[model samples]
Target: MKKPMRLSTVAFFMILAGVAALGVAWWTQHKLGIMPCELCLWERWPWRVLIVLGVMVPVLPARVGRGVLWLCAPVLLVAEGLAICHVGVEWKWWPSPFPACHAAHVVGRTLAERWASMPLMPSKPCDAPTYLIPGLPVSMAVMGGVFACVVFVTLCVGMVRSKKIRRF
Candidate 1:
């Protein structure tokens, strides 16, 4: 017979998944030199929060730990919503909510003044989507949306199963 999954195991998996996703973002930014847009940076925040919750879940009481895990589902859904919004911005279906999506315009009159006012490294425009896989039509934002949905579904299922297990 297969052993049932424990809350701690699920939390650990969440932590590992969050770390792995962040690690890929770090690698792409540092190694591949792909600077993230403002929306892209916003997407990372949910994973960071989830990772923190995952760490705390193990130390809390069983019922409380499961409640914390249950809380992750909504956070993942919100992340998914953000990813969808970003994908829409990338596709030109909607404008980005952030001003960083627009190109920087220097107000200085002189060329020297304008050049001095410009930022050292140009921030990536939110409208431009980064594709990690070569020759693939999918953007990183789409991938993030799909991953968020998967994680959200997993959390939902785990929560249901955990409740059923508790009943008996």
Candidate 2:
């Protein structure tokens, strides 16, 4: 018989994958000099959820953990979609949000005005790619595709394993 997959083992690998993905994102930003746009940063929130779930599920009971993994499916799918879209936007495949991506300089009349307006304006936009390799045309989002794939694959694997375990 095939060895039963341990919840802890799956969770551990998932967490490790998430961490590695995050590390790659950071490293790509720093080494490649790609700057993240506002939406790019926003998209990361879902990935953060995956990472958290990956670690937390191992601690929960088998039933609860499986449920959590199931829940993670949609979240991972959405995150992947967002990352893919972001990459497309970076490549000009689709129109990005209006007003352009990235922070704009506000010439406020006074220091207080500038401070007050800061709350109203985001530091970055969806159109602007924060980081790009010095010579390469590819943006950070392009590099991030790998991370999305990782999440997608992990979610798929978890689902398959869960089904197999339940059948037994």
Top candidate (TM-score): 1
The residue-by-residue lDDT of candidate 2 on 17-105, one tens digit each, is 66776676687658765555666666767767778988788778888987887667787677777778887776678876534364565
The C-alpha stretches of model 1 lying farther than 4 A from their native spots are 1-3, 164-168
- Candidate 1 is scored at a TM of 0.92
Q: Please, what is the TM-score per model?
A: 0.92, 0.69
Q: Candidate 1 lDDT, tens digit per residue, 37-74?
A: 99999999989989998999989999899889988888
| lDDT score at residue 49, model 1, on the 0-100 scale | 84
